[model samples]
Target: MVTANKKKIGLLMVLPAIILFIIMTIYPFAYMIYASFTDLDLSKANTGKIIGLRNYLDIFKDQLAISSIEFTALMVLIAVPVEMVLGLALSYLIRNLIGEKILRALFLIPMMVPAAVGGFGWKMLFNFIFGPVNYFLNLFGIQSIEWFGRPGSARIAVLIVEIWQWAPFVFLILYAALQALPRDILDAGKVDGAGGWKLFLHIELPLLRPIFYVTLLLRVIDVLRTFDIVYMTTYGGPGSATSTWSFYAYKVTVSYGWNIGYGSALCVILIIVSAILINTLTKVLNIGRELGLSKE
Candidate 1:
């Protein structure tokens, strides 16, 4: 009876938090799912009529949606690998440095900066008139390049800013993992003829695999949900060149039009895509083991 009462008490203590989670997260998600199946216009807030799967079907035919998905994919493909490689290299270099701790802290400054500030800073730096980038180009007799005024340049600018802001996060995670590595195993490798590139490729890389997968999974989700930078810098401008899926959904619902139902559908699609990609990556990496899920 005492054990049963103790269990009941424990359950009672957790019940409030569970209720709050249902209220805050589960309820909104359920509502959004319901709204996606209806013509829920903000203008006519309460008069939505069910439309079945029409919104889902229409999403494929929407050109901007297609473009946004394509652009987002391109950014993920380009940015994630570059960040991972750079982060790993930097961690390796810094690991052997005298001031590794201070340098690591300094590297985190960019990641600590607010996204709005970082985006605006990059935007100003890339400006054509009186911007440092253009001034530097002028010194070499090259004309000023309109970074955000052209579609291709705008995409490049966004990618550069994103890579700058996020690479440090990847570095921090990988660096911590590197530090936690078994020195005995590494020393053993060195004794056997593994040092430099051979040591890293054969020993370090394998140990770092789990952390790398975790970083990749996180970066992929973050890239897909990229918004503030695009909003503050490109606004998906220069003719939809930098429009990510999140920004496209914003344009559909709040900015360009007030199609709440369609926007909800877009959000649902985004959630589904993110979940699918994360699930695939988790399986490929066997992340459950890394996370200690297999232990229990």
Candidate 2:
């Protein structure tokens, strides 16, 4: 009887939270899904009427949407690999350094700064007239080049800011993974004539595979949804060279057009693409585990 009463009390305690979740998260998500099938302009939000898959169909025909998708894919492909390689190398180098803790803390400063603040700071650094970048180039007899004024430069600027701000996060995760590795296995490998690159390539890397996959997955999702830096620095200007999918959706919803329904459709598409990518990565991680690559 006492156990039964405790179970009932526990259920009662969680009931309110469950109700709140349904109201706040589940309901809003369902509503958004519904809205994606309609014409929900902010001008007449209350008069939204269902238009089936028209909104979804329209997105493929939208050139800006296509461009944003391409740019976002490119950013993820380039930035994630660059960050992963740099982070792994830095973590390995710093692990054997004096004052390693202090060094780690210093590296984490970029991650600690607010995104908007970092974006604004980078914007100033990349400014055309008074920016230090242009000043340095001028000292070399190079003419002032616009960092955000041209399409290629604008894309490069976004990639630079993103890598600078987020590489520290990847480094921290990888460093922790490296530190937590089993010393017994490493000592065994060393005794078995496994040293330097041979030991790392065969043992350390296999153990770190799981953490690496997790970090890559997270960075991919983040780069896909990137908006703040682009908004602050370029505003998707110079012919939408740096507009990610999330930024494109924002432009449609609030910046350029007030088409909420279409924006919701874009959000849905983004969600779908992210889900598929995450699912595929999870499968790859599982495969790695099954092949005896991942430790735990």
Local accuracy of candidate 1 as per-residue lDDT tens digits, 184-250: 9999999999999899999998999888988999999999999999999999988888999999999
C-alpha lDDT of residue 148 in model 2: 94
Query: What stretches of model 2 exceed 4 Å from their correct place?
Result: 44-46, 285-296
Total backbone collisions, model 2: 0
Cα error, residue 262 of model 1, in Å, equals 0.3
> Which pairs of residues collide in candidate 2?
none
Residue 175 in candidate 2, Cα distance off native in Å: 0.3
Candidate 2 residue 199 Cα shift, in angstroms, is 2.5
The TM-scores, one per candidate, come to 0.93, 0.92
What Cα-based lDDT does every candidate model obtain? 0.92, 0.91
